[model samples]
Target chain A: MSSDHSHLPSETELRAKALESLLVEKGLVKPEALDAIIETYQDKVGPRNGAHLVALAWTDAEFRQRLLADASAAAAEMGYFGRQGEHLKAVENTPEIHNLVVCTLCSCYPWTVLGLPPVWYKSAPYRSRAVSEPRSVLAEFGAELPEEVRIRVWDSTSEMRYLVVPMRPAGTEDWSVEQLQRLVTRNAMIGVEQALAPERLAP
Target chain B: MRGGHDLGGRQGFGPVNPEPESEEPIFHDEWERRVFALTMATGMLGQWNIDQSRHARERQHPVAYLEQSYYENWLAGTEKLLIETGLISEGELRSGAATEKCGKELRIPDAEAARKILTSGGPAAREIENPPRFAAGNEVIVKRRHTLRHTRAPDYAQGCRGLVREHHGAHIFPDANCDGEPVAHHLYSVEFPSRELWGGGAEPFDVLIDLWEPYLTLVDGNGE
Candidate 1:
């Protein structure tokens, strides 16, 4: 079935503005609501939430078990439940095995936890190749796992979103949750990079 | 439908040169934010389900589907759904005019509900009368052929043999969700060997997909 509105593809920004103005004029979508939604994701929700969960898992073992068992509920306990995160699954990276997340069909991410996905995560190259050649992808992201280590690529095909809990750095065993939170970066939780070691912290 | 949106195991895309996370902005420009907000807010109208909205995006011409940026597709899909659901029209879309107040009769969410809407996301899982057909540790084969309508079964895993790793109880069936009454089926996390999906030269690893019951069939004890 061909689209009659084929001409609408060009001038993306202009078209977006037209649509928004139409909706706002019709009293269907409030401009303030759009600003609120944008602000929520932009300021409040994002990688910091995932970092908090990772930091807690590192400092508290029982929370880690709960998180691994039922991520959605565990996340809700810390108030990290929302869109793209209803059925969240937390995957732990161990010395013997590594985990990476990708959505081949579309970008399905834990929006509430990790905020918006990075551009590469939604790009065609990463979507097409991540599942096929994860070692190369991981290497490009500066996460070079040993050849002996197994890789589990979780394709987010369904509603079940995944978050990789990167192995806690060795030297930070005694670090506080607040300090450990600083080491957990957004890319690390996506399995593209490992959590930063204590010495790597910024001066 | 081996829709063009299915990018798994496909080749020839260049390196994924990701921007350094320190500098990458969540929304590259203001329009992206508008598109996202508009899509999410429009989605709150309850005119269409998530599967339908996704189909709107995937059903576009392959060139449009692949060439457009992520948010561009979202805008395209939103426009398509808006027109298809009678919430808007091609004329209105073109003129940026609400002649009919097409959305006047609709139940639209306001600014106060943004937080509630994002946090209490639309959960797809449901309780159905039928019990799950497959269980953990069961060997299964993905059915090669199914309807051409919207489906979650990816092209790479079609007709391949795999093991049932886990069973997620009844959830909304995406394929059947294209039309008619809502239905739910058991969704299983099926694990296929990378070699099986790509080739023997593929990096040794496992690729797992969440497939509904209809997309799979049981394999014999002989591993046939």
Candidate 2:
């Protein structure tokens, strides 16, 4: 993944480097702290954490009850509570009702579970269109729900972050939590798309 | 204020061209990561709350706000916060050096402490003895006033009537909290029908938004 751009850093890159050096020199921020925050989001916390919770909800009925009842507490039970997810509200997708989440004002995502939000989530197009034309937006993601099913869009205006527990696809009854987790994509958890079907997972 | 950041329900923006989830990278480049980290680290300084940081970003001109990328907006917001809080002067920032040290004693968290603090997040919910003005099943209208500062009420819901779906207990009101006047208010999940917001062409659906008490007013009778 290395490129021959060692001598040609972008202007933003230069400014960031300059800011980091200044902050460090001023003792306002530590270099190690910066790396830790990046690493925490990059490696430790991610969609895999959310996938674990979704898989558990699919397999364990009692856990699903707790997750739906109070998402933050249930997330803490699984050791997945933190910044950007202080007040998580899990909205499950059912056959009759579809749930979609978007931060109209800003990208208020569940970073503790979903890690840093995708570029599109913060983009102008997604922010404006998600609330106005959710169905069309989901269609762009190739998520086409039935016409009869009611769509409920959750606009995250406050500190409350939303997590969409996608419905379990057909033909995955006997699958283990690990196997089911492989089917849960970050987009599905964000309610842009549905969880992968069993056939799609096959090579 | 009707800032560029609040872009819900308004039109003229084009289609949402989303990248395939399987292929999208977390950070498009190294600088994006750096900007993100810097924002979070400086935010930990406790000089400004999240709402204030958001207001800083929204304070930019509409054209600039729309043109700037996500991390670019974040970097801009960080610069505003630093200057506003007296942590660094514009001259110092321009020089890329510390001209004068901040007089106030600021507690800067180290990497380990930041990790711990991030893991155990700070919740905005507060324990207030005041009762909620609206309850579930009650019809309420979103106040139509616009303020030129930090506000949690989105423009799309302004003047729209919705049903109170749930009472979310007391939480720090962003409008007051951002102004350095911290006050607790009951937040509720208001459910507005799509037709109510978008008119006849809208699909049969409901949009739920969490609104603080001050942003709402109860309907007199007949559910409006």
Candidate 3:
């Protein structure tokens, strides 16, 4: 049917009408059923798993080596990688230069380790300027890059997802794995913020 | 029924929010709100507003609750509309669906699901099929293409001087002339002296833009 009619349906009206017709024909959508199914998988495979793997890597040098080299296999070994994990790649940030990621076109991310991408990552200002003026972009988030250090901007245009393995923060020298995991927020992995320190999180 | 990830800012067709800090308007149904949040978490902010008269027609027409399933169908339809509009492509739309499905399956909260879909695998992992025409360290020029459609390349960079820094692989080709094919193209890091992008005493070596291959051409020392 043509949408050229003078009177158009309100989104709410269309939704009500649409739902009314579909349910009449096919029955209830089992909305809660869908949610339960989603809950099972998330519990089974999600960011929490990715976080655990990151914690393991932080403690083990060998694990870190393998993680940076072949992230998918390494993550899979820990039971974190799955359907979307096949193309997962890990980028480690060092003191000299920092790596930041953006989809520019869309928010293509690695869900297993880093969790979900934020509103800003998929924003036009972030996408358009992040690659061109990364330093400035970082500055907006309060992340300043040294002039001497070249900023490497990764523009994710395909299925290849990225995670920023933030530098282990200073003064957290002896923090336990569980404690350290608290510092690894999703924003830190996006290069928008630095890894947290014990002092920063003190209540 | 717009593409989930097509935020209004990128399109440049709408005015900035009247109240930037206020919470955005939410859908009537909680599930609908969940879907909206999930879409935004991955940074797909586009939505379908009901055409005014149709909204009235629906109220007057009256329908069953079960037909609400059409809201989901409406979402699917909107995604197709975005693909045709060049706001996104089949690949992007498909991945968005995958994320939506995954979000539903995993029960991950909408914000969390959005983040997962945006940062995790989908188009982010797939390799750009075709390498860019240029290479890093090489001087290139951005091409000027004007249309009413949405594009990743900015207008300021058109016909401007830039140096290719690196080549990122191909993805969903946004150029409509190519007919919505997911062609391989390079994600070239093009350097634009701040002066070129924004006039006045800008930083010397500071340049910008990680442009796709289709946007560039070789610019020799004499300049193209």
lDDT value, candidate 2, whole model: 0.87
The local lDDT score (0 to 100) that residue B80 gets in candidate 1 is 94
Per-prediction TM-score: 0.95, 0.96, 0.57
Worst 10 residues of 3 chain A by lDDT: A20-29
Query: Which tens-of-lDDT digit does each residue in A88-169 have in candidate 2?
Result: 9999999998998899898899998899998788877788877778888888889899999888999999888899999999
Alpha-carbon shift of residue B14 in model 3 (angstroms): 16
Query: Which residue pairs in model 1 clash with each other?
Result: A46-A115
Sort order, lDDT high to low: 2, 1, 3
Can you write out model 1's per-residue Cα lDDT over B11-49, one digit (the tens) per residue? Answer: 877788788899888887778889999998898888888
* Per-residue lDDT of candidate 2, residues B147-186 (tens digit): 8978889999899999999998888898988887778899
lDDT string for model 3 (A152-174, tens) is 55556434567778778787778
For this target, which candidate reaches the highest lDDT against the unseen true structure? 2
Question: In model 3, where do residues sit more than 4 Å from their true spots?
Answer: A1-33, A36-57, A61-77, A80-89, A103-106, A120-160, B1-29, B32-133, B148-151, B154-180, B186-196, B199-211, B221-224
Q: For model 1, how does the per-residue alpha-carbon lDDT over A96-118 read when each residue is reduced to its tens digit?
A: 98989999988889997999998
| Residue range B1-224, candidate 3, lDDT tens digits | 11222221133312111111112221334544444332232123222211211121122111231123323433444444434444344654433322212112222234354435433433422364444567668888888876534455655567788777655455444442233334445565666665665565543334445566667777764423
